[model samples]
Target: MSVIRTAILGYGRSGSTLHAGPIEKNKSFHVTAVCDVDATARQKAVARFGCRPYDDYRRMLKEEPLDLVVIVTRSDQHCQMTCDCLAGGVNVLVTKPWAVNAGEAQRMVSTAKSSGKLLLPWLPARWGSDLQRLRQLVVEEQAIGTVFLVRRVEGSFATRNDWQTERRYGGGYLLNWGPHIVDPPIQLLGSPVKSVYGRLKQTINPGDVEDLFMGILTLANGILVQVEYTVSTESPPTWFLQGTRGTIVVHGTQLKMNARTPAQPSDPTQYSTMQAVPDKMLEEKLAGSLYGDEHQIYKEIAAALCGETRYPVTPASALELSRVLDAIRTSSNENRVVMM
Candidate 1:
């Protein structure tokens, strides 16, 4: 197949670093055009990639015979930009969180279906080394017997003044870091969520949006997944998983796990009189650096565009995440658990 001509809308950190870097390295894709509202960013794109740059994405879409358009703009712009690209007969790869709200997410999915173009969300954590290792230990190897809980925490002390801390731009821990932390647990559990409980607050940030958030999702299989993010704390373990017979902890790129053999049944008559003893535990640890580009979601975009494989981050999954996100917001506002 011919190289897929691609256009990226947005020249922010995510646009320049996450999308552009990978697309340039992959032979399957060619960065033919880029559009940004900022003139400086547009000029830089032209100088860096030698691609056509436009100040407006609508004009770029109209002029370029692009096969795929990657939307890495502000969170609020995701839905509308995706709709326009799909309507213009170009496939779309939207950076997560895919939309500002569930309603917008639904519309984007519908547009993609009606237009017969692929709508893929960029969820890099789904392929992250740390997450991948945890999945192998718990899901594949069953090193952690009968996993019961998964916890992910991301915390840092900072005062931000950028658009990231603004409500109008969909700036908040829930929308900003929610998708990255939430998607992996859903993939690991492999079950439908039954209920959601959440708490959202603005701590040290000077913006109107939330700087701290916690969400508890109970899956249909009874596994509880807790996702938390804060701008108040200095450090926290990035991941924690608990199972009936083992536990796993991760900090940055380092991972440590403890596993034990499940207790075997003793005499039924002694159940009331005998005291159970814990089994001998086994421990393992690893510290390694992540090859960031290996987790890039654009490779999947190229494969999907080439008809080589189905895109793993499907539109249905994106919609499910959006629904959960909306439910979390509602739960926080109403101070009650929301049933899914």
Candidate 2:
């Protein structure tokens, strides 16, 4: 069998639970190494994968001839790690906050372009059936005329209190969770942001970064998106969309999408909603979520990079997210609308 040698650069919780297991299961990709800064974590990663361990990413890329390097480390290290791997002649698939700001995203994008290496964001959220259906619905000229509003809420009691509390670490409610929630809206809207107004409140985190954040985005195409999120919430989770036709609301991981999009008579629009439910809900790309059959994500990504199919997590999409995030932070700090 032809398998791409893949290295996972972090073996933390998200890395272990979400990424490694799934990717290893793909059969098309071999888990060549698992990396982390802590010696104990490295030992465990090595034990788990029966692969070598490296304290430094630079060392890993230098010693191992890899087909792909998946970055699951902190925000500060993401860009440098990505650049290093690309410069080392390896393809990269890294976690979000692709950079600290839009400028960083641009540089990374430029590097990927020049090196001819694939750089895609780790937004598996886009891999779901519901979002793809929504994207398809928008493209097919559905009742959701023009996609006027995309309102999303990324709720978690664990996130804000955990790694998201510190701004210096690129920690915050938005930075931690906003990427997944905001991806669909931006993709559906397909409009470059024109301006943004933001509101930030430090609800739980004792650090400089925000805890609960909300932003109003005005796209160049005149689409408006509202991103509402918090790190502390026990309420029923919700992620939703609205257009001229109707709405689609997915409550949680049950593939439970309650949709009301622009009306479609005799077309069984609800079937589209029902069809949008993902057969699986994977928390990370390298691991299986709920059950088996978890190889599609990397298979699709590798295929897309090799010009066989389309990979949903494009660098352009990552750039768009960063741009919106930059505008939001600027608007919140300057106390005025900022143009993107």
lDDT of each: 0.84, 0.72
How far off is residue 209 in model 1, in Å?
0.7
| Candidate 1 residue pairs in clash (backbone atoms < 3 Å) | none
Quick one: best TM-score, which candidate? Answer: 1
Per-residue lDDT of candidate 2, residues 1-340 (tens digit): 2567888887887678777877867766777887788888888877877888888888888899788888988887788889889988899988766787878888899899999888878776666555555566566746444567777666666533555577777787677666766666776667777888988887655767777888988888887888877665574444566655455554554323233343334665446533232222223122233112336676776686566776766788788788888878888889999987
Cα RMSDs, all models: 2.5, 7.5
Name model 1 segments beyond 4 Å from true: 232-234, 262-296
Root mean square deviation (Cα) for candidate 2: 7.5
TM-score of each: 0.92, 0.82
Task: Tell how far residue 195 is off in model 1, in angstroms.
Answer: 0.3
Report the alpha-carbon TM-score of model 1 versus the true structure: 0.92
